[model samples]
Target: MTIEGRHVVILSGGISHERDVSLRSGRRVSDALIKAGARVTVREPDEKLLPWLEQHFEDVDVVWPVLHGVSGENGALYSLLRALEVPYVGSRPTAAMLAWNKATSKALVKRAGIATPQSIVLPNDTFRELGAASVIDAISKGVDFPAVVKPVEGGSSQGVSFVNEKAEFSRAMVTAFTYSDGVLIEKKVTGTELMVGVLDFGEGPFAVPPVEVVPHSGVYDYAARYNAGETTFFAPARVSEAVLAEVSELAVKACQVIGLADVARVDFIVDESGKPWFIEADPIPGMTETSLVPLGIQAAGLEVSDVYARLAEHAAARGPRNTPATPNLVV
Candidate 1:
């Protein structure tokens, strides 16, 4: 099924923490698709999504769900797309449930022998009733101070904080709770932060060169992730070939292990030992010029417009993912 001039519907801007960023991504993709000689439309997700799709999906040769976090990254919308019989990008419903949960993603990657930082998942009551001492003790036993505390189910680094002392530990947990019911207090592994973009074009996973992020001191928070000029990205991360190969391999493994397909990006922390520590996998990584994935893809000698066009073509070629529980199949 060739999608030369077919309509591409890009979904974005839901009522989530990353709504603005998602909308920016959607706009970028829409513009790129149009530049590539394809018809494109950008739509915000709301109560009218199903109705709008019911009328327009068939005409839409590919659905580019550029939404981020909850409503977009979660499995619900993906499941809806599957039922609609519309070809959409990114992971399926089952995989999203696992990757969306910080605790679950880490557990799965760790179980698969991928190196992930130790984390303590704290429920709300445990933080309020059990006290910060309990939280500190539990996390301190496995990790040390200068740890990262954030929502167990979150993206774009929302509700994330760095706790350097006992006094800030509880506050960070509270901040994390502002975004989610549970908090993940992870062991801080200080090192160069790297972002790996993995794209599945129905021919296994291929990783775009990794990008090194150098965030200003004490500013690698949510703002730095979405907005511009908060960080510097060095595409084709300056590392040895062996380390790069290993990083790429682990990133692909993490995506495959989580059952993510179509396209996704994996973030990592390359420790002093040069070992990559799995952070989180984003099914709908941002596509803004400031996005890490686009930079890496371009550094790999592929234009952003080509990437978007191929994604649309990939969706049109590969149908639904959840049907019959098959990861690789064309219907």
Candidate 2:
């Protein structure tokens, strides 16, 4: 499956808060591509991304966009990739844009009849124009005290907070607003935190085994994400086979409904009722040492190198399918 001499660019490093982590992911992915024997180049994208690629896109066979959040995940770079006519490894421009914004994603998934926690989107100006009371009341009416507040467009749980008091709500909103223009307030479904990996291969998208995330302290934050031991991920999650099957099916449904292609990691919160609620869809996800996508792939007994090689092949040969994409191959 190796592309051999074909040049692949791993796009990373943006103006987002996750830039450092994205760079680390780019390094790891580049190393894997090198081991897989594909000529690899690492590119840090900004407004100059297009000009930079125009200089090299002709020689590039495909792009493995490792960028997370905003410009990278929201189709900014993917659009450029399309204009340049280089096949990229992750979700398409339109799909990535659709999935990156929390409000857009929630609406689409809810329309698909998936169980998402009660939530509301509030822009910073919306709060400024009105007041914090209205925003807090909106959250209070839908979600009770123990609530989750986060930036609508963020990664690695960068601006996420667990609020247990009304006094802390303002702080949480301010925190999230620093990362994004808007925030989403969701009812904290405290039970099991599971991440289901979805891989869209040549045949179609197949749901890989679920992974249970045990965060050391304040949930899965930036420090907990890249700091390794801060979080423990159990593959094939400890849930029963029936529950696993149900969760996997739901994960695949979420991916398809949101227009995601390539690979996606669907985050879910299983409530006391055993119902899985969609938290959000991670389009680019991550591939650093602390990332869960690579861990899930390895847990399936496939080498990381082989996964990258097959993924390269998948990227080179696959198409952006709104329907079933599980062509004839499975990764």
Candidate 3:
């Protein structure tokens, strides 16, 4: 579809911890869409956003929300868009909520015969009421050493920790709890970290070439994710042909299993034995200068602007799917 005269709103920069990253992503998307001959607006979500959107609803073709972390990924923004009878890119609100929760999504993927790290979910109240010391003892006995502790629902590794020894377990749990009321502790799997980007674009979902991330400090934390030189990325990842094919196929299946549409990034940890273990899926992936989605798109022999423009066009043409019905007259 032609996007020559399309008007798109790229919503970004919400109250999430990844607000800065989202802003950068919105800017990149806006520039890309403009290059594709579409009128673009980069708007940070605020109190007046809904009113403004309602006023200009007919003028806009679609809304491409780049709000990362909680602000955008939690499904509220998408739900609001649906309520407004506006077309938008990415997954529906139900799918967004399912994918945003790491533990829940992992469970769903595992049910589809995917291998994921064994983990436990603990609520803040449960941990505190049960006594931290006792809970720690139970966790130590249940989960193996060298585990990963992170919030149940968050991105950009905001409050993630790697626990190598039992002594470091408490601090890791405490750090994770600071970010979310629910925390996930999984037995850390040793492997090469790989990321796969999937693009549906109205057709059946297909996986792009995988990208291998090599963090300078051995941890892809928030700083390493956003900072330009903090990590070195390899497009068409340095992996065996077998590994690549398996990872790519798994990525597409993960998207289907999680009910994601449009675009998503599935992270995996290929163990030393060459087995891919599903980590998590990001429905609203980062599209900043250092993000992996753009790299994946480029690796697949496509331009970022063209891909985004096509997404906008496809969404606009589809119109609203879950728009609410009007009330009946009381006569």
Best by lDDT: 3
**Candidate 1 vs 2: which has more lDDT:** 1
- lDDT per residue (tens digit) for residues 199-300 in model 1: 877778889999988886555777787767788778899888888889989999888888788788899999998989999988788888788888888988
In candidate 3, where is summed lDDT lowest over 10 consecutive residues? 322-331
Estimate every model's Cα lDDT from 0 to 1. 0.82, 0.80, 0.88
lDDT per residue, candidate 3, 22-106, as tens digits?
9999999989999999988888899999999999988988999999988899888888898898999878787788889998889
TM-scores of the candidates in the order shown: 0.94, 0.92, 0.96
Top TM-score model: 3
Candidate 3's displacement at residue 195, Å, is 0.7
Alpha-carbon shift of residue 78 in model 3 (angstroms): 0.7
lDDT, candidate 2, 50-88, per-residue tens:
787778756877788888878688877767666677777
- Where does candidate 1 have its weakest 10-residue lDDT segment? 322-331
| Candidate 3 lDDT | 0.88
Candidate 3, residue 66: Cα displacement in angstroms equals: 0.3
Candidate 2 structure lDDT: 0.80
